[model samples]
Target: MNSLRKEPLGGGSSEPLPVAIIGNGPSGICLSYLLSGNTPYVKSHAVHPHPLLQRKLMETPGVSIMDQDLDYLSEGLEGRCESPVALLFDALLRPDTDFGGDMESVLTWKHEKERTVPHVVLGRNLPGGAWHSIDGSMVTLSQGQWMGLPDLQVKDWMRKKRRGLRNSRATAGDIAHYYRDYVTKKGLEHNFVSGAVVTAVKWEGLEPQDSGAQDSRPLFQVSGFLQNAQDPSPQPFILRARNLVLATGTYDSPARLGVPGESLPFVHHELAALEAAMRAGTVTPASEPVLIVGAGLSAADAVLYARHCNVPVIHAFRRSVDDPGLVFNQLPKMLYPEYHKVHQMMRDQSFLSPGPYEGYLSLPQHQLLLLKEDCQAVFRDPRGGQKAFGVSLVLVLIGSYPDLSFLPGGGALLTMDPSQPLSAKRNPIHVDPFTYQSTHQEGLYALGPLAGDNFVRFVQGGALAAASSLLRKETRKPP
Candidate 1:
């Protein structure tokens, strides 16, 4: 199981992997773990809050996650707009809140080399995926405990690195380092193709009759660029896969304001850029007030960072502070004090304040209409009065979606709505709850945010579901 089993093609080259994973984020990592012969088993006398689930696991001797009835475990536990399998997985892993309660895992890993599935994880970033790109100092929305993949705990990984973490509160840097380390530590680095940008994934029809591996033919032709670390130039490659899993996540593409000067040198899309500028002394107290746009958590993070650095900020957003739909309004004050402070500033119209929100101008229901040559941001307020603000930098943290341009018709075939482009924000891909396979296309599956399971804790379940489906299919195949 240490080496991926692959049949050689006519020219002494390896054939398409039996299963090809897109995006080596948590989803891909989880799949890599499960498919690499690390089978899961319910621990005997495991303490579970759900009696039915506990009994189900105990009654079935030597029950495995892949062989369990996932739908039965998911019933009455999932929300209206939640992945049921994810809920079941969370229950199995944590047995309570994702924050804490389960210091130990309720399951055990059993290595079975014969059950290993030949697969490759193709990702555009390092093993950690987009998490490595986030601002290191910035903390995650969810606690650190919710961020770890199966088998390896975040706290344990931190201990191995000799880092002292007193609580579940973890910085982005900690999570990022953990994910990158998890790959090598778990012996998954060999299967991962980092810095891979998949350009296209088209159905390439059945394999030739003379192929060596007879279980399944190459169903997908995956085309992407493999980036060179030293050269910075991309190396183009084409691959075929028997099964394609879309665990790509939706953080790659940043949603645009679609206005003038948005592409200007002063404007920025990600928080990482702003953090970089601050560290480089480009953004300081002497600099013009930074104009922060959007109504999401990222926008709030911008405000918090700017205010902490003593840099003035002009906050602009579409929704009012009182709007129930506003993300800030929904967040509890206790867990998210920094965000609550930003929300308070928006509600109180805190401008030129000297306290927590000093030099902060909160403009609710304001729109940025234009950005001038001299870093001037023209905005239309709620009263329809157009005001201009002189700012050093502009940040648009509106939101993001998965870039599915590689698929046909912008991946409309996999989405619930074929007329619209594939987007997790607009509509999650239509997938079977049990298998996580694309309802529209066979041998094509989705995991994580693509399948509407957006939380870090829920990612493992999606991979587990896909693994179960793949294994079941293999069992039924003719010898």
Candidate 2:
């Protein structure tokens, strides 16, 4: 863990300390909120820099903070920016504003014309021959496998998610709105910028400076920017600051399928586009067979969405049929006495009762298989296999690995391969659980999934760590 240090970097007099945070995910966003003094849930804990000190840091005309969004996501939505959650819309923006990408338009159109699915009925939780109405079936939204056990049923898990909690569908987008709203009600300056992706971060060490108050401390210079990766020759962003923080997230690197035809637009690294299509009714629910590869949360979410759209989904994995499903992986028979006995019995019979997935037999004759086939590569069938048989989409929910190409020279200042997992110590950026500063880099700090060594990467944990780090820094008294 790194202890927080504030040193002067000689740059310019009467200049505000310009801080640049890379990546706009939870970590970067949280850092930006801290600098602006607008974090509600975590503000009370930060040891704020003396206002006089901050004013000095802000004196430099070169000082400016940037987030990933140029505008809030709710800028155009009718009810998007109204509620407390709507605050996240304060700086919402479409990707195209900076990246020259057009995926947001497709998402919005789909959200408009897409069929409204109140929810989904999970067939896996039902008893044999158990029937249910379309709206009454239990659709599994989260899986508990990441918790370590594999036999636990999705419905029975609590630590994974608080299902009964209010606003079950609350997403990161919703949280962003809520945070922005809080800032508005408090009348704080919510300065933010979006529509750009950070391509690089250049760190310049600290220097001594005169405060013009008879005594001066060390200040720092840090600079970087928001630009498109597609540009052959893009302009570089620059900023100067007394202190610097790096909060780019693991997801900053887009994961790749490394398979053939992956270059096709139909295959996506994120569900933003897929959700858009579903919302637009472009991807209709029907008898069409849809195949989803891999068994992670993304795959589970995809399955539920397809089910809601009335699409018959076929889930294929490299795991054996005897291999555990999420339920088995999460709540194995040993952990739950009753379920264990039941699971053991089913194992003996080579048959198990229907649950979430199998429970949705309303249409009857839909197939969902668990296969152990490796996705060596993806290619169209010689005769357009099932696409002609109404297999409208072949969504490979296989996991994504980090793509460091966006980093200048196709790499980052910190070099840890996402392709290979680390054993905690070898990881980059040591964080002080107390101060959240990087032990190796004084002004640099890290938070979110990228900071922790937990096997399961979650947005909530990152937000919590970031909030804690912010509070600790705000509350600390300078020596």
Candidate 3:
């Protein structure tokens, strides 16, 4: 096995640091918690489930009702049924449990002996990343169960707090609060360094090996600025670790509409900015028929919020209403009646229209030309037709890309292929899908949306894959 070696840094201790996880979002929280080996509290008595509920849970996706009881299923059946939280808990927390398949050996290794490797998490705040930056009222597109970390079920947390049933969607604040609580419950708060922004991650190359021997292991120098509680200035610090995991998500850099006058005072990108304007009474209903760009979930949110404020909206999309795989087409109407209703209304052109092309205008393959001084938008039709529309405000809800600005060497270390379309250019870090280790850098790993696993429920798989890879590397003999 590879032994830990101490490296002297700026007069700091010579203790070897095994892992450093960047960003305290769900991915980082789950990885750090699992690495710490904190045992979850289990009830002494077996929980009995109602016959009807037991049968129902047995058919659930990630749930195996035989070993795990059904009483835990009732609290949040909606969310829990979709995520693998219960499966992960059973594998990692239960005594002598088999993780099964290829993971059986990797996960069981932790229980065979005590782990003493040191690890730390760096982030800007307790929640960190997009979860901390999002608006409080923003509800997730996925169910609450999908939001659970590896060890703690979001349903169990909600039940303990008497919040609500597990089937409901979680608000941004709800998810953020759960993450904070998870850190405290897992005793990971001591390992977390808040208000610390990792400015750069540099590869220190491979250690010098004996002649004719190959060394695949690489060292990483992680440097960042820690914000002082009292002082405005930040203190610089450096940390060296054997492995690095980046989970800083994709919401760091938002995509922009490259049009003239995009910097106008009335243009906004996020829904929070528009809500703030409404609260300040700066934007009024008289500024009717707000022009919204994009066709994703964020644009839908802007439309709903505008409707709530009694403001009319001109929903503009680049594709036709009959476009394949639209957000509305995929959403279950019964589960999201309000969203379905609003989407239908927009399609039927029921809302007030400020232009000639009805309420629902489809600018199929359209190109935005300019945003005029008088709050007018100029765009070209798919067939070389040009049109102008009047609007009080323009909400650009275009999606965001992953911001890997902190990675030194620009494209040298991680490059966006020029062959791919502009939208897919900011592709996530390239990693071995099964291991989640960087294809180019040996010791670097990525998780969460930053690694292209966008859904919360599915992100746990990436974490597991990464953790398993780290364990194998750490325990393997150099030979």
The TM-score-based order of candidates, best leading, equals 1, 3, 2
- Candidate 2 TM-score over all chains jointly: 0.49
Worst 10 residues of 3 by lDDT: 1-10
Runs in model 3 deviating more than 4 A are 1-11, 14-16, 38-113, 165-167, 208-216, 350-366, 409-426, 475-479
Per-residue error for 116 in candidate 2, Å, reads 46
Give a tens-digit lDDT track for model 1, residues 376-431: 99988888889888999999999898988899877777888877766776788999
Could you tell me which 10 consecutive residues in candidate 1 have the lowest summed lDDT?
2-11
Please identify model 2 stretches exceeding 4 Å from their true place: 1-18, 23-173, 186-188, 209-237, 276-282, 285-288, 320-328, 331-391, 400-429, 453-479
lDDT values, one for every candidate: 0.80, 0.35, 0.64
Q: Which candidate number has the best TM-score?
A: 1
- What's the lDDT for candidate 2? 0.35
RMSD (Å) of each candidate, 1 decimal: 3.6, 18.4, 8.5
lDDT of 2 by residue, 1-479 (tens): 01111211222334534344444443343344444443222111222122432233233323211211112221232321222112222112121222323222111111111111111000111110011111222322222221111112222333344543222222332233333333343332223333233444444443544345553333333433333334435334344544444444344334454555555545555545556667776666653455555555555566666665677655544443345553434553333443343233223322123444431311111122212123222323323322112244456555543333443343334334444442122444455543445554555555444454322223222333343443333343221
lDDT accuracy of residue 409 in candidate 3: 49
Candidate 3 on 1-479: residue-level lDDT in tens? 01111232221764436788887887787777656653222222322233433344445434222123323433333322222333343333322222222221112212222332357777777654478777767777877765777556677898898876323687887888898888887667767777777788888766533367776567788886777566677767787778989887767667898889889988888888778878888767776568888878888888878878877576777776667667888887766776776567556662233333233444445667889888898887667778888888888888987666677744235423434422222565666766677787778888776666676666665665666566555654221
| Candidate achieving higher TM-score, 1 or 3 | 1
